[model samples]
Target: MPDITLLIVDDHPVVRDGLRGMFTSAPGFEVLAEAADGREAVALATGLRPDVILMDLRMPGGNGVEAITEIIARGLPSKILVLTTYDTDSDTIPAIEAGATGYLLKDAPRDELFTAVRAAAEGRTVLSPAIASRLVDRVRAPQGSTLSAREREVLRLVAKGTGNREIAAELFISQATVKTHLTHIYEKLGVNDRAAAVAAAYDRGILG
Candidate 1:
């Protein structure tokens, strides 16, 4: 089999160096390039088209999600494997929704990282244990999300800073109906209030 070409995208030089050393030393992998942030990653990826990108989530310029989104939009062949320190829903959900092939934490073992890269190179989905459980819970949640059209309309209005009464007026529905939709939205998004719901919706791709 051909060596799996890789682009390491991370803000920390030390972390990038470590990953470079590890992957370069390992057989069946080739380190194609290194990028300091998402912008650099995208530029390098556009040119190099590596087999896999080991990407970090948070960076000074252009976050990992945006880079993943852009790369997917451009139809780049590289499979994105997010290697980040964050595992929160706020982080993992967006990266996955943005078309990452895998999500692995910084604390993952070297062997596991290598295995994940191989799987990602083949377009398989890989997620850390914690992230996998979170997705499972969301899938098994009681109110089975898959929002109705009217409910989605309410959420869009809510995201745009519209009040319940205003949403009711805009949708030609009563305030009580708006409240019901908000409650379902909160349950589906696993958030308590409006702001959290909006944020979670954006993170999970429930809303744009």
Candidate 2:
């Protein structure tokens, strides 16, 4: 297996060092870089191109959300895993919205953290078990609005990168109906574009 190189992004020196130690001690994982704040995180991540980035949610000079947005917008290949103390539903949704592939608490056990990092490196998502129900709730409740079952099916295909006609063929629905469902999905998710909708779906854990 290839080594999983990680970038640690946290404002606290102690936290960065501690995580670095944990990752280094774990077999097949390596600490590639450390950044004290979001800007530094972006710079180091851009330069070092680590396989995964452990990002703290709160920090100075750009913040984790903005950093994730910037990194993804710039087409960085690294996947971001948010390592934070905040576990509120509100916090969870936005961090995922910001392009985090995984979320874990600061107090997560070493075994869990290692597992999460490994899953993230392998292009799988990881969420803290503590907030798993909250994620399901967020998707189900969805700010007092919901997608129809059919619309959701269409969105799932869209999330998988299928075009309207492809979705139509796959679901045995008309292309026009597929477009209609996409429109409803866009309205419900408050996204103006396909990529935005896909991002929202993944953020809400509606799509893996």
Candidate 3:
């Protein structure tokens, strides 16, 4: 295997030290640099151009998601591998969407960590088994909506530029009932007006 240089990014000093120690003592790996948080990680990554970055998701400074976004946006060459303790939807989804090459928990075994890093360096997508299982479950499970069928109908009518009274007549309901449905639609979609509600619905694929 060829030499793969790395930048270790974590807010904790001990974690950084431990990662550096392990990678440096191993063959075919070079610990090129380390950063305390996301902001420092971005700066070092831009300058050092390491083969891979072992990034932490949460930190006191700019979090890992933002750094990963910025790095990918700037077309940086180094692949990012998220090495955080968080595996929830809020954490993993954004980091993966932000262009992280891999996601691995800090509790991952030492060999698994090495394997993930190597895979990340080769531009492969890696996720811990638990993380992968959660993602699969989320995909396979049904997404229950907070909006009712009638509310969705109202929103669809709103998207089609139908007036309240017209919608009421078409649905054979009173104008007051149509207005009430609109109010419920606005609340469920978290918007204030019909136009915003329509836009939100379309954005969430409820209108499309």
Candidate 4:
């Protein structure tokens, strides 16, 4: 098989250099280019059309999630693989939802990273062990038990004594949506009202 070509995207020059060196030294992989941010990643991916993109989630000019969304939107063939230090729901979920083919942490072993990149190039879903476990736990959680990122946001607002109207305004969502989120929260927490939900959230350590 031909070597898998890659575009390494990260804001830090050191990280990019390290990734480029790692891939170039490995067999069956080629580093086509390096980008400093999401916008640059998008531009390079569009032009080079590499087999895979190693993306870092946080950057100044643009973010990895935004770049993944745009690349998918523009019908680019490059598969995105998130390589970041964040494994939290907020970071992992959005990157996956935004069309990343895989999610791996920066601390992943060199072999694991290589395997993930190869799998991504093949259009296979790849996730680091930590991310995979979190996803599985969410799926196995009882009905309405696992709060989505948005639901967590709504719950946090509720805990702060923010009314539905205020939450809607703050989150840039409709009041109806806020209400819907509350309903889900109630069901998940096995509470009938907002107050109980807030207490349950606190008990479950969903809110800090």
Maximum-lDDT candidate: 4
Give the better candidate number (1 or 2) by TM-score. 1
Give lDDT tens digits, candidate 4, residues 104-204: 99999999899899899999999998899988987688544678999999998888899999999999999999998887787666679988888888777
Task: Give the top-scoring candidate (TM-score).
Answer: 4
The lDDT values for all models are 0.90, 0.85, 0.88, 0.91
Q: What is the overall TM-score of model 4 with all chains considered together?
A: 0.72
TM-score of 1: 0.71
lDDT of 1 by residue, 18-69 (tens): 9999999999999999999999999999999999999999999989999999
Per-candidate clashes, comma-separated: 0, 0, 0, 0
Give the per-residue lDDT of model 3 (tens digit) for 1-208.
Answer: 6799999999999999999999999888999999998899999999999999999988988999999999998899999999998886668888998999999999999999999989999999999999999778666743324567888887778888999889998889999999988876765565788888887877877877
Clashing pairs in 2: none
Candidate 3 error regions (>4 Å): 144-208
Q: Write the per-residue lDDT of candidate 2 for residues 1-208, one digit (tens) a residue.
A: 8889999999999998898888788789989889988899899998999999999988977789889989998899999999999886556777898788999999999988888998998889899988787678657777414667787788778777788888989989899988877776776677888899888888887776
Candidate with more favorable, higher lDDT: 3 or 4: 4
Error of 2 at 25 (Å): 1.8
In order of appearance, the predictions have TM-scores of 0.71, 0.67, 0.70, 0.72
> lDDT score, residue 197, model 2?
86
RMSD per model, one decimal: 9.4, 13.5, 9.3, 8.7
Q: Residue 84 of candidate 4: its Cα lDDT?
A: 98
Q: Return whichever of 2 and 4 wins on TM-score.
A: 4
